[model samples]
Target: MSTTINSFNGDQQQSSSSPDVGDLEKHYIDAKAFILSATTKDGINLYDHLAHCISQLLADQPREGTDLVEDISKTIKSEATPAQHDTLRDRPAPDSEHSLAAEQKPLFEKVDHSEELDDEALQSPLPHILEQAYYFEQAGIGLGKDESYRIWLALKQLADKGQIDKLRFWGKIFGTQKNYFIAEAEQNVDDETDENELHEEAHISDDNRHPNEEEMDDEEDMLPKSTYKPPPVVPKEERGTGANKYTYYVCNHPGGVWVKLPIVTPAQISQARLIKHYFTGDLNKEITSYPAYPGTERNYLRAQVARISATSSVSPAGKFKFSEVN
Candidate 1:
């Protein structure tokens, strides 16, 4: 994930002063990472911090650029109160007699220097989202939600850059939720040490924590997590391939030990039990290569460990169910 951050973090300047292109990228990237973390910390919880960063981007994004800040002393403005709408405060008193006078006043009247300065900040993605949400809620409106972009990069980019409203999608699965049920087993197969010994192991600064044990705590939380595995959608050209020749996508967590499962049959429990055997090179090729499909009772075992490859990733907030096929 560090490489991904570096690739996207170009030479563009990012500072608190009106969001430079880089600043926008950083917020966008951070938001993605927070959601993917198995850590209990979540987006709604960090909204205040996120709101602050987003506000800065807005303050820095306006038309006047640096000039607005310098010219701040030049304008005057009025304070708006909760009781009355200030924008309409200056309306003409009577009827048609003074109608022409109201047209002469600008739509946004200049009340104070501070207000004018505040108006010049550029529109930021964060505020843009918040403001839109407020208007929609106020009007009590509803719109259809779509789910394809959670996994679609191009569509995501467009939505991120304001070319579209970030979409909310619905999964094709029959259930209301998109996450899948997962039960994996873990084992201490390769290490020569316990927690103390593993801590003393040499450190490498790269992203993929080769034998990723760093997120051990979060991994524990995800241990019993439900996942939503996308049902395999073989491309048009690959449709006729026989099951034996097809490649199976393994969904399991990596690193650590202990994969106790609940309520599955003895046979399925048996598969989870051999997790060590599978990782230790003692399993049959057919057993290890067993085909998997969603919603089918394929007798299979879940990876006791659950996590992304040590490689850092920004997982979007979508879910999948982990199922075993007989």
Candidate 2:
């Protein structure tokens, strides 16, 4: 035998599954507040039209096996219209704009003293306040009447806010913070290093060593403090026996033959090609004509190599020529 589904009437039996109308109305009010807070009105009426649909949905329950809340929510959302949905989606929450404005006010506007006002009137200006106002008004380094007014207003605000004591404290130390005339005590790096070294030395002891620490210490002691040594200067007679100790370009002029050109600056490398132009018209053509060569042999100009070593110093004390070398 086949059985057919039977429909029952719950409202007539006083046992409907639908939520109470009062509860639905309360939810509608809260939902309206949330939607209105984030969005402006569109073509659809959000509250009146939505409330009407909600009332209908609550009074008439959905068919069998349907969700009561989901059906009511769907009915309410349908009233929003497509245009209203777009507006709600595009707009930010009203509370967010208000909070951003409050945060920016402190940075752009003068400090607020409304809290301390407490319905009381502002006090008369003190003697020091008038003096400061007068000084600013009269002194002509761009402190005009506007600045004077601002100063007076700030002072009055401070007094009204019960922050006059703080203002006085800051005034006492005016222009002293990080100023050249104020000598702030500074820590010396060398002194700190010496103190740290002393502390480390004081802590060092034979008893403090681990089992492998003695071996590490012995290895450290065997090693030299530094492995570096300056390259040995080759004798002038034995120019290329090993790598050239120091390469120099000797000046070809008879008066400046003793002078050796050293690539002391970065500019000399760049100006190598421009050497001809630099010395073409000058009396020092002999010195500038020769391009740089390695290993101390004079160019085709017959200039002798001046060997650079510890015993020798550059000739023509103040006559060193500089060039831009790439």
Candidate 3:
């Protein structure tokens, strides 16, 4: 009995040490079912699933620098070398004709105004003017040397072209968009004839007619002059007198086109004093303001220039004695 009891205890110890075959078989079956279920849900075979897991593990592993360089090289090798060569070969060459034309073009246009300029005109007084200007500059009352030189050239050109008897730089007037470089000149007036004088003479002769001669005319009898007397006419100012003594030419710059402003009338001067407006650099622009201006912007500018000159211009006392003789 003692031997049998010892043998039974030995069997119990062996059973506890060894795993059960049935339990091992059940665990294997459960693991196989789980893998099948996962594979089916993922829509891949077990071999493919195992391969994907292996690839992920390999990807997660750190790569050597040489392996990274090899991958970049492979990517570069995939591009078409023939296509790059074809693009370079097909590019158009630069235009030689356009370059040649640009090279041949002249930098500045040639201007010919020789026919207009007078050959017998007096030589330019630039040297004398420059000396005087230098003196004025020392006293701090003159335009700078550069500006004076440019203006002198412009004036000299004007004198030659216009056959002016005398020319003077009349300073500059600032405007909104541009400034006017003024040149006051005494031009030969032999070619010009004032039509106003003829009209005035005709009016004077008509007024001086006898009353009997007026009644004898049938046209005069037809007209009724009961009322509506016209305003007294302001006599037209003579040129070479007062503000009209010199003809004024204006330009946007020293070398620009010179425009001769119209003669200023007394009415324009009176009207200009009633209102103020900034210059628009346009000659034909109408002055629109209270007490409507009788003329355009050019007239207003001339009137103002005259007004300013009369008030501000100075001269050395007894510079020249007034002469009544010819």
Candidate 4:
């Protein structure tokens, strides 16, 4: 019988009223206030339009490690040169175009107490919310919003509609997770030491030897049973033995490596190719042969193979570097 295959995506049913943001409502309201008052009644103007777009993008999800309130605005960028976002920096953090002679209500202070707002709100203004989303999407960084909870809920709803059990649903969602191997056609085995130890340790008197022969004939399971062969556990310095990098992340069998090269501009690509040529000299006669590293990491290869690719200029300085400062 042909069986029907189904999938779940319950987040689509969520509206602004959804409970996921219950605790965040106050922040949401305050943010909405800033956005609404920042623009005119026609909310669809570039100001509100961008905010709505980004808010919608993030509305249904939470980033892995990002605080929505903290990172949201920085990600927005106006589609203007050097960054039309600079306009927001000039005024009280409003996008430059929106900064007119209009009376500005400071969002940072509580009107009654007359307290000074923190410098964070003052200096780090998010010019346009939509611009941040656009730039982030273009930059190819993970939209680090957290949607795991909602996604899990979506899966639950799916199982209910399909009349499926938890195990079956898990199997369907992630394919069967085999955490054993078949011992010929009749048996399967688990991997543990004592239960799997050979009969050599059966050091008793010889009286029971021949009669118990049949028991020793049975197949035994070994610990660390058949798994995908992992990379060779070599010391860090052993890496890049014959290559440029002395250390690298292993992503494949025996000796795999993963390197990330910037793919932001053509000039960067050209530079990358040149670096590759420099490292992997031409085939003795060509005078300019591209270098070929041992593994299959595109970023690593690009660094030494293709110099003139548009993958290195997008993020520079502190914005795109992949290091965490203490």
Q: How far is candidate 1 from the true structure (C-alpha RMSD, Å)?
A: 36.9
Steric clash pairs (candidate 3)? none
lDDT of 3 at 216: 54
Q: In model 4, which runs have C-alpha deviations exceeding 4 angstroms?
A: 1-114, 125-228, 232-326
| Candidate 2 Cα outliers beyond 4 Å, as residue runs | 1-131, 136-139, 163-326
1 or 2, which is superior by lDDT? 2
Sorted by TM-score, highest first, which candidate order results?
3, 2, 1, 4
Report every candidate's CA lDDT: 0.31, 0.37, 0.69, 0.31
Clash count of each predicted structure: 37, 11, 0, 30
> Candidate 2 lDDT (Cα, whole model)?
0.37
lDDT per residue (tens digit) for residues 1-326 in model 2: 12222224434445556678999999998887876565334544445655666677668855642556566656666655564334355666679547645543433356655566533344332345456656655765433555334344443433443312223201111111110010111122232222432443344434344467467577745654465765643322222222122223222111111222221211232333344322221212334344542212112111111111322545686688788799
TM-score of every model? 0.13, 0.16, 0.51, 0.12
Best by lDDT: 3
Candidate 1 TM-score, true structure as reference: 0.13
Give the clash count for model 2. 11
Q: State the weakest 10-residue window (summed lDDT) of model 1.
A: 247-256
Candidate 2 lands at a TM-score of 0.16
* lDDT of residue 46 for candidate 4: 47
Task: Name the runs in model 3 displaced over 4 angstroms.
Answer: 1-122, 125-127, 192-231, 313-326
